[model samples]
Target: MSNYIVRKLKLEKTPQLDHLARAAGELYSRTVVSFWRTVRKKNIWLSGYTMERWHTSSSLHAHSSDAIVQCFYNSLKSWRIRRKTDPHSKPPRRRRWYFKVIWKSAAIKLKGGKLRLSNGQSNSPLIVDWYWEKPSIIELGWNKASQCYELRACYKEEIAQPINDGNVAAVDLGEIHPMVIADGVNTDIFNGRYLRSVRRYQNKLKVRLSKLIDRKKFRSKRRKRSIKSKQKQLAKLNNQIKDIEHKLTSRAVSMLKLRGIQTLVIGDVRDIRNGLDYGKKNNQKLHQWSFGSIRIHLEYKCKKAGIKTVLITEEYTSQECLNCRKRNKPKNRNYRCSCSFEFHRDGVGSNNIRAKYLGIVPVVGLMARPSGLRFHSHIQCNLTDNILLGNPRDSIAGE
Candidate 1:
């Protein structure tokens, strides 16, 4: 199996490059909109090749135009799938003036210490400084905050051999604790407090910036400067959030591999925000939750590490007491049952999820004291000193 990741590089701003990228965005919008109009009006589906032919006069490379068509078709295909379950699901109809420009393998070249991106036959090629091997595809994307264009290179990497030891683990995903895993014998909790704090700071900064910008005249020099500064800060915070996500997922996968775990089950909370109305503050926090991003990172990293990931509905995984088979929503981090059996709430959820997936009854005697880990920016992961539930205090150190 093969796995791929994207590396983003900042591109120096130039008038020619800016014009080219904006033109590519226009071409993308025109291609999608034109094809969609044909589909709606003529009730016909235009093939990618046919759409590519329609863009013969485009300044973008032939392969770049093909990428646009491919993107449009993918959106249409996704909409088709969603419409089966969601009757009100709409097709891709929005049009944008500036879209990210993608160049396929055929339009990319690397020579010596330079990378060349083909625009078209008559236009000058975009040659940039390069030191790494050529990537499979390249994308020129606009950064509105910095008012610049950047490049993203996608490269394929070989995947590790599949782990077939048959050991399985279940994960409970939440906003406070991003991931909590249990494998009947071992339990691990990954802390997400830092991620939440960073997001909170971002929201506060955004509000302050918005207020300051609103106080100034619209489109004035001060307002524009404030807006740009705000965007730059938000972008920096966004990057920090992404850094945490990558490290968290990577560390989790690495630990799981070390545990000789093969299959990973993740609790699905996809619709947690559909009609959520838990007051202003709570609503904001939930809306900002990035479970989808965490899941995506986990999925790809697991694939690369030859670990299977599965999602199962977790309707009562969190509240149901494993000991008494009764529902009791924990008020805090610890869950206590009427039968006197207690454990970390997230651990209990993970255990129940595992039980549901494996079609086995949840047993307290089979579970171990859950170990806790807190993620830090300076370190990969740090073991937290937490009191073990129903086990010796040295249980974490033994692991």
Candidate 2:
């Protein structure tokens, strides 16, 4: 399988490059707005004919114009698809700046320790310091937050498929556990309580900052600085969370590969929070959950390893008992059924998810007498030996 990775190159800031970037951004924004208006008025899709008609008199360089048109077309296509799925979807909005570089030899050139960028109407290229190997595609853009020009180089790489061992694993995602996996032989529960704790702490910090800002004078320089500092802290926290998630998902994928799992079944809960009223506190917690991000990590890692991934609707996965097949409403972290089956709530959900694909009701005692059970948490612990039935307190102990 072929996949691409992007490497960012920070360009040296200069007056000339800044002007060029600003001009490109303005031109891109105008082109997008005009193209969108034409599509709406003519009730037609974006195409080369429409692009040629719209930009015939434009002053933008040929390559730059082509790149902007392509980007707009792709965005429009995606918006149209989303609009069909969601009737309330709105059309794309115009931006103050929308800089982008279309991949072309004329638009961008690389040399020893420096790169050349096309300034739309100039014969001479804007030269900047950079050092990188040639890439399949190069894109340039300006980051408003950082106030700097950035280059993104895309390089394609081959992915190796894992050797198949006829094993399948079912994954259940939840707010508390994050991921619960069942691979026939064992059940593993990954604790997400630490993540929840971190989120709660961050939320409290934000609330304190908000209250302080509200009490301060309007448009005060002190208030603005405070807000900026809070924003920086929040951004740093978010980056840390992302790093932790990457490590957790990497470990999960490695475990699956080691077990020779060929197929991965993941429960899909994307629409679980749609149009549901679960009270204020519960809703806030649900919103804070990173279910989508976790799924994305699992999917790409599995793809890179050539392991098949299937997303099955998770309706009633948690409510249905894996032991007796009776419907049970789980309370908190425990699941109890009328047939005397009791287990970790998330584990039951994951086992049932695997059973769904097997087209059979799960055996009553499978979860109770699993071949093995493993507990993992984000915090450091001495349970690194991978021992079967290790102390749960050591694994899930508070950080």
Best by TM-score: 1
For each predicted model, how many residue pairs clash, with residues at least 3 apart or on different chains?
0, 0
Q: Model 2, range 167-264, lDDT digits (tens) per residue? A: 78899988887888987657888767667777888899899888888887899998998888788777767766775666667667767877778889
Candidate 1 shows a clash count of 0
Per-residue CA lDDT of model 1 for 196-282, tens digit only, reads 899999999999999999999987999999988998999989989988987788778777777768899989999889886899889
Q: What C-alpha RMSD separates each model from the true structure? A: 7.8, 7.8
TM-score (C-alpha) between model 1 and the true structure: 0.76
Compared with the true structure, all predictions reach lDDT values of: 0.81, 0.71
Candidate 1 residue 301 Cα shift, in angstroms, is: 1.4
Q: What TM-score number comes out for model 2?
A: 0.71
The candidate that wins on lDDT is 1
TM-scores of the models, in the order given: 0.76, 0.71
Looking at candidate 2, what is the lDDT of residue 19?
Answer: 57
